[model samples]
Every structure is written in structure tokens, then in C-alpha cells.
Target: MAELAKTSEAVHRDYTGAKIGMWLFLFTEILLFGGLFLVYAVYRTKHQADFHTAAAELSVAIGAANTMILLTSSLTMALAIAAIRRSAKTASIVFQSLTILFAVIFLVNKYFEWGAKIGHGLYPNSPELLAQSHGTILFYGLYYVMTGLHALHVLIGIGLLLTMLILTVRDRITNTDFVKLENSGLYWHLVDIVWIYLFPLLYLIT
Candidate 1:
């Protein structure tokens, strides 16, 4: 039974390695956003008035709604992990599906929000945007870049969660071996946390 023992050891090593790898990847993501946040702080300080005025153009109602959506998705993701750990496969699948649904709703809201701004000629490099104060320009630039990046992450999270759902259905991610689901949930939470910061910084600058 030495072979069996060696196989068990290898599986344990792989599980530990996967967790470490996911954490390292998340750290790099944090670094990327951290640098952008620093840049935003510098610019906002240099042109506080312009930043405030520009932020007023954003719809607080919509931003708050999206914030709620992501927060709910984070909750569903956590519940998904908890469900799987308890061997409630169907419950896990439902929670995962709900998480993805919330993500989609968040993106839909963002799409309309961006469309409204674009229709009003507020987007980067638009004639109206170019005519705005330098601070206004910088504010919109950072807003678009940061929010767009976060939306991309949400899309990626949806895909990851969808995969997890499929795997759960196929019995691949059972109660005993669910590290993959856990990793996906961690990533999804990061996306939500990023939006939590972004909403206040970009949408509530008053």
C-alpha cells in the first residue's frame, strides 16, 4: 500500500500548491489596482474641485444599485462554497448560479450607465470631454479605465463560476475535493471588493 500512500501525499501537495498559486496571483492583482489607486489619489489632490464636479455627473442611484448587486453576489459565492463543503451539491449549484446572475445584472447596469455617458459625449477623447477642464478629463479617464477593468474581472468571475456550476453538476467538485470551487469563490470576492472601493472613489466623490 506504499503506492497508495505516495498518491495521497501527491494529492495533498497539489492541493496546497493550488491554494498558494491562487493567493500569489491575487496579490499581483492587488498590486496592479493599488498602483492605479495611488495615481487617482495624486490627481484628485491636485484638482480636487474638478474631480468633485466630474464625479457629480455620475448617477449615484445606479452606482449604489450595482454596489448592492456585487455585494449580494459575494454573499452567494460564499454560500456556494459553504454548501459544497456540506455535501449539498444542489444548493451549491443554486448559489453559484445566483452569483453569476448577479454578476450579469451588474454588467447590464454598467452597460447602460456607460451608454448614457457616451451619449452625452462624456467619454474619453470625445469633443465634449476634450473641452472639459484637465482635471475633469483626468477624472473621467481614470473612471473609465478602472471601472472597465473591474467589469472585465466580473465577466471572468462569471465564467469561472459557470465552470464550477458545470463541474458540480458532473460531480467533479464533490464535498471532499472542492479546492477549485474555493479558489473561484476567492477570485469572485476580490472582484466584489474592488468594486466596493471603486464605487466610493469614483461615484461618491462629493
Candidate 2:
């Protein structure tokens, strides 16, 4: 009985430490993203026409769809953590699985959208990338740069979620030891949150 109480207290302290560290790491990430956003703002003001034209070229349908998918994934991820907190291992696993599925959907949407743009000469160094308009070329160049970076983060988030899925399935990590899981979820949520801010700014800069 005393052993269980001691274990519980130790677990509580460890959880607090892990979560705080993750939050601090997220703050650092915010600063990085903030700097990039600053650069974007400067370019946007200098080339408003080109920026608008570039924004228009982005497919709103796919962007909006991915936004919804990521939002849903965030919700599922939250649910999974909640389930773990409640000591419902099976429910947590199920929610984590769903979160992974939503992540894949988001990746697929991003891939298709990006690939189409690149195929249509929307990438730097591509023969058709510049679209013959000064604004189009500059705007598309920035577009690819920003979205490409964000997409890389998305890919990393997917890998993190998959790691959680594996840990849950293999019983290698359970609710009792969910700090790594929580940390990964934190990272994934940050990725989603960054996109939430990026989407409207990048796509609606008119």
C-alpha cells in the first residue's frame, strides 16, 4: 500500500517535469516560426500583388480539407491522452490509432497538393516554376519555401505519432508511463497549431 503511494507520487513529479520541459521546447519552436513569419510579412508587403496572385494559386479546397483533418487529429490526440490519464488503456490505444489515421490523411492531402503545384511549374528551378509573371514567380518561390518547411514538420509529426502507436500496441508503454507519449503528442499538437496559424496567413493574404 505504501509502495503504491510512493510510486504514485514519484510518477506525478516525473510527469510534471516532462510536461514542463516539452512546453519550454515548444516555446523555442514558436520563436523560430515567428522569425519566419516576420520574413514572410516583409516580403508580402514588398510584393503584395505577387503575394496575392500566389495565394490565389494555392488550392483552398485542399488547404481547408487538410486544416480540418489536422484539427480532427489534434482532437483525437487529446482524447487519447485523456484516456490514458483515466487509466483506460484500450481506449487510449484506439484514439491513438485514429489520430494516426487522420495524420496520414493530412499527409496525403499535402502531398497531392504540393505535387500538383510542382508539376505545374510551381517550384524553384523548375522550367515552368515562374509562370511568366514577375509576381507569380516571386510569390510561388516564397510559397514553396514556406509550405515546404511546414510539410517537413508534418512528416516529422507523423513519425512521432507512429512511434506512439507502436508503443501502445506493443505494450511497451502504458498509461503508467505515458510521458514519452505525452511529449510526442505535444510535438504533434504544436505542428498542428503552427499550421492553424499558417493556413489563413498564407492563403488569405489579400
Candidate 3:
């Protein structure tokens, strides 16, 4: 009994350490995005008219749809973690699959969105965009950079969820050892939270 207690305590300590490390990494990500957002605010304040003009060019429907998709994915991710903690492997896999599907849907929407913009000659350094006011150019520049980075994070989150799915299927992540899924869930939630803010800022700028 004493040996089992010690083993459990050690696992608990390891899990705590891993959580601390993950949180520290997430903090760094926040700082990275924070700098971009600061630049965006400064530019937007200086060029409010151009910013609004450019923002009007964005598709609110697509942005809102992607927002809902990400929000749903976050829910599924949380459910996957909960299912794994309950030792419900099949349910966990299903939830993870749903999360991945939603992520892909978001990317597909983004692809069409960006493609439309490019088709209309709105991409960075494109003649149309360059001909626009400095504020319009800056808006699109920040839009591509910030949202592109967030999309990369979405791809990474999808990979992480897929890994969790594989591990769960292999019985490597179970009720007794599910920190991997939990951490992935945390990362996925962070991705969704970032998009939640991005949606309003980029799509609903008034």
C-alpha cells in the first residue's frame, strides 16, 4: 500500500510539472500575439477611416461561421478530455475526430476567404492593395500576419488532437494517465480563445 501511494504521488508531481511547463509556453505565445495586437491598435487608431474601409471588405458571414466552428471544436476538445478521463476511449476518439473535422472546416473557410481576397487583388504588395491608403494596406498586412499565425496554431492543434486520438486508441492514454489529452485540450482551448478575439477585431470592426 505504501509503495502504491508513493507511485501515485510521483505521477501527480510529474503531471503538475508538465502543466507548469505548458502554461509557461502558452504565456510566451500570448506575448507574441500581444505585440502584434499592440501594433494593430496603434495603426488603427492613427488610420481609423482606412481601417474601417478595409474591414468592410471582409466577409462577416464567413468570419462568424468560422467562429462558431472553432467554438464547437473547443467544446468537442473538452469533451474528448472528459471522455478519456472517464476511460471511455470510443467516445474520446469520436470527440477528437469531431474537433479535427471542425478545424479542417475552419481552414477550408479561410482558404476560400484568402483566395477571394487574392483574386480581387487584395493581398499584400499586390497592386490593388498598394494603391489603397496606408491604413488599408496596414489593415490587410496585420490581417494576413495575425490570422495566418492563428491558422498555423490551428494546424498544430489538429496535429496534437490527432496524436491524442492515436494514443487513446492504443490505450496509451487512459483514466489513470491522461495528462497528454488534458494538455492538448488546453492548447486547443487557447487556439479557440485567440480566434474568438480575432473574429470581433477583424470582422466586426466598427
User: How does residue 171 of candidate 3 score in lDDT?
Assistant: 93
The numbered model that scores best in lDDT is 1
lDDT of 1 by residue, 24-142 (tens): 99999999999889999999999999999999999999999999999999999999999999999989999999999999999999999999999999998999999989999999999
Q: Any residue pairs clashing in model 2, and if so which?
A: 121-129
Write the residue-wise lDDT of candidate 2 on 52-105 in tens digits. 877887888888888999999899999998898788889988898888898888
lDDT of 1 at 54: 95
lDDT of 3 by residue, 1-206 (tens): 99999798766658888888888999998899889899999999999999998999999999999999999999998998888878888999999999999999999999999999999999989999999899999999999999999999999987888888899899988888888888888888888888888999999996
Regarding lDDT, does 1 or 2 come out ahead?
A: 1
CA lDDT, every model vs. true structure: 0.93, 0.83, 0.92
> Per-candidate TM vs. native?
0.94, 0.88, 0.94
Model 2 ranges with Cα > 4 A deviation? 1-13, 131-134
Worst 10 residues of 3 by lDDT: 6-15
TM-score of candidate 1 on Cα atoms, chains taken together: 0.94
